[model samples]
Target: MRTLRKYAGPLSDRRFRLLWAGQGVSTAGDAAMLVALSLALVSSTGSASALGFVLAATAVPRLLLTLVGGVWADRLPRQKVMLAADAVNLVAQVGIGVELLGTVDVGLVAVYAAASGAAAAFFVPASGAIVPSTVAPEHLARANALVALTRQIAMVAGPALATALVVTIGAPWVFFLNAGTFAVSAVTLALLRVPAVAAVRTGFWDELRQGWREFSGRRWFWTNATAHICWNLGRSAYQVLGPLVAVRQLGGELSWGLIAQGAAIGAVGGAVVALHVRPRRPLVVANLALALGAVPLVLLAVAAAPVVIALAAGVMHAGLSVMQVIWQTTVQNHVPEHALSRVLAYDWLGSLALAPLGLALAGPLADRIGLPATLAGAAVLLAGGCLLVLAVPEVRRIGSRPHQDLPTAEE
Candidate 1:
């Protein structure tokens, strides 16, 4: 019973509950939107290039504006920034749905994608920064775990739901449904009574520079961020090559799907574990856990059986899920409240910056060398990078406590 309460403790806070519920729905909606968009594009244009262009359209604005968005999130009320983002997404999804209902216009879809991406740039940092305001300090880890669980669940179920809905009610309605989910999120944000955070108004560029300084000053943070970049790069190998290998060697799409399901289930389980465990040296533990991500890459490279690869994938993602929860909680606890969003924005940018490059290069690298060799190299790099981050004393020294005496950018 105590264990149950520990897992459920975050929900006791009304604000956290609202935030969690809204994000849960919103995340699932976003996942569904991805499927609906792809189907709509393929059905209309029959051009993979168009699909890729529209997808890139979303990423370009996000990459360009993420830092600016982070600064704004710090300057403004995080909740308000989120609300505005929700509104923008609602409009964009609606536009996409309406257009799909008529004729799928690639240009308009790209425009909507850009708008949504820009909104996400603002929304993500605010969302991460706002969590500390919603839940108690003691419950922060569990809260993060809960949020991670929601995302994992959504990743698994959302696509299935979208696929079903697309077949039944059509892609337009799926977009419309996604719009409604955003509305739900907006209403929740509107209702939230977040504790006021004192805004530090400064020159936008100055604030961005300050954020960079804060991010770079923390040895633990930057080292971990660097590791995360390498981690993402390595993981992209499996993402790009996994399906191809599965089809060629294993059994086809079904095997790939099972592997994905294994990861999702592992992620869910990892979040559950995170809710209960509080490691003293969070970064140390997180790095150790994240090293497990390389297992699947190694297994895939060796031409392991589907079940074996799936199990390795499960272990890998479970570790990732735990690492995510610990990383978020540690950042929230250590970073000063005023600069948290900006710092988080830097983290977000650094973590994702190399992923596209990795995705692009993975296929070429595999072609040049061999699939097994490329996968093995990525696995080694992923595991080695994670373990190497542990050599930073700060990473090993940081504790689970909130508000550690860490230096700020101003210092």
Candidate 2:
């Protein structure tokens, strides 16, 4: 009874329902973009480094501007920020679509990717806060679960669909279709009636300093944030390397889609598991769960076979999904509502700090050394990163109860 009710309660809320449905459509488009972009780069250049360049172009801007996004999300109406981000993304997508349809300029595609990344930095921080703003605190865990579920379902369908379209009609139309989804997302946010919560109009730097204090002041917080940084570096490497190998050795876009779809199927199961079981030491479990991510990267490097690699991806993503839920719920419940977006921004900044560097380096290094060796090193670093985070006593002991206000921001 409790299990069913917990899942159904958030969906019953009209506002959450609208946000949930709209986000589902948007996520599918994102998944499709992932497939289309990778295939487009590989098909055009046949160079792994070219693919990495585009990925790096996207990550660099996000890393640079994410803090500014954090400040705005905390100060202004979050839904409005999201709407603006969506509008920016919508225009960027159209640019990419037009460029793809006419003359394929790799440099031009990369520029658009950077623009989209800047918009995403703002979208992500605002999006992170909206759930806590809209849903009851008690139901936040379940609400995140539903969000994960929708995203996972899209992951299952979108890649397969993308590969089919890319194989037949080509990448430009797939990109144009993605532009339409952004329109859907913009419409939903325009209608969203977020409860108006007053924000402090602190000087911009002070807000960042305060958020930094709130974030770095907590030992568990900083430790987990560091862990995320390491994990992202390794994960970005895998994302760039994985698709190239799939297209070259495994069997092209269809195989890439299969591996992605398998991960999505597994992620759905993990999300369902998260909806029911709230771990007492969520940070500890999440850290251990992250260690599982190393497996698929190792599999891809060693096997390079579709069936085997897809199965490994499934196991890896199941753990990834659960860890994501636990981490989000922990942060949302712990941070002060007024400063939540800024703190979340710091968390994002800290976690993704090295991703651009990793994405930039992964291809060039792999070309020089060897793909298998590069992947194996990443897997080793990924596991080592997880264990180091687990070594922190604070992360291991993080309790289920909320810690809304830390004892001291300076401590």
Candidate 3:
């Protein structure tokens, strides 16, 4: 009880609490948008290929602009960036919602999605870099855990709300709700009061180069990211192809959402556990958890029992969330705050570079090799990628060091 009390006080910080609330709302909105968008694509075209293009449009921006976003994150005030980005997002969502009311043009939706996604590309790195500024070093794990929990809750609520809206009101309203969420988030963010770190006077390109230097110079940074590129590629295959498999091969959207929900539930628990227990070798723990995700992919492909597949998926998601919390903490701790955004941008670029390729190829690959065979192949690839990291000495041996350069907080 004493230990628990000692560890549990991070959530009481006022700045973090406001940030957390805003982020929670934004996450829910994003989730709702995802649900509405997916349903819109499926209902309008009834083609997996169409959905793939939409997904690609939404994602490819991050792969392209992540570095630029990072460069700016290093040079500018993170809080201001967040505030401006959310305001931009609010307008974009409203415009899209209004457009959707007139036509079912998927292309128009794609264009709006691309614009919003480009804005999102900048938002992520800045948000990630700013988080450490709001809390003490000892409280990082708890902070990250709270963030993950909010994300999970938002995801669960968002999809459910989207479903109800789609049934009751329509798809256009979902976008309106998304706009409202960003409005609320932006207002809350504007209310936050923290001492601003002055922006450094660095040219964009030079700052970008410096961020790259920091990213590539570290063995642990590149090694883990490289492994994650492979992992995310496979995971992307699941994201794009999984629903198609469920809808066409299994049942329909409801079944697919259920499968996703199972994973989300597991992830919530995983985040909590990660917050409570700080692993020595966070990379090792993260890699092991990532490897475990392959179990469900293989199980779903081979096993005919639906319950078995669902159980495997739940375990996979739970493990993945644990891996994410550890990964976030390690990156934030080791990277300098001034350059953290750009480094994170590089991290996002490297990790997600192949996601579009995976999405593009999954359908065709499944067509040629068969769904079960393709899933089995993905499982093999996921395991192989994880094993590659284990072979690297830095990753295998790396552990959490004490906050030697930073001060610890009192509870």
Best by lDDT: 1
Q: Across residues 206-243, which tens digit of lDDT does each residue of candidate 2 receive?
A: 98887788778887887788778888888877899999
- Estimate, for each residue in 149-255, the C-alpha lDDT of model 1 and write its tens digit: 99988988888998999999999999889999999999999999988888777798888888888898898898899999999999999999999899998889999
Candidate 3 local Cα displacement, residue 279, angstroms: 0.9
What C-alpha lDDT does candidate 3 achieve relative to the native structure?
A: 0.78
TM-score of 1: 0.98
- Show the lowest summed lDDT stretch of 10 residues, model 2: 402-411
lDDT of 3 by residue, 119-224 (tens): 8888899888777878887887788888987897787678889999988998889989999999888987888776666667667777888788888777777878
**Native-to-model Cα distance after best TM-score fit, residue 105 in candidate 2, in Å:** 4.9
lDDT (C-alpha, whole model) for all candidates:
0.91, 0.84, 0.78
Please list the residue runs of candidate 1 whose C-alpha ends up more than 4 Å from where it truly belongs after superposition.
Answer: 406-411
Runs of candidate 2 with Cα error greater than 4 angstroms are 1-3, 38-56, 105-109, 167-170, 236-262, 296-310, 359-380, 403-411
TM-score of each: 0.98, 0.84, 0.88
Candidate with best TM-score: 1
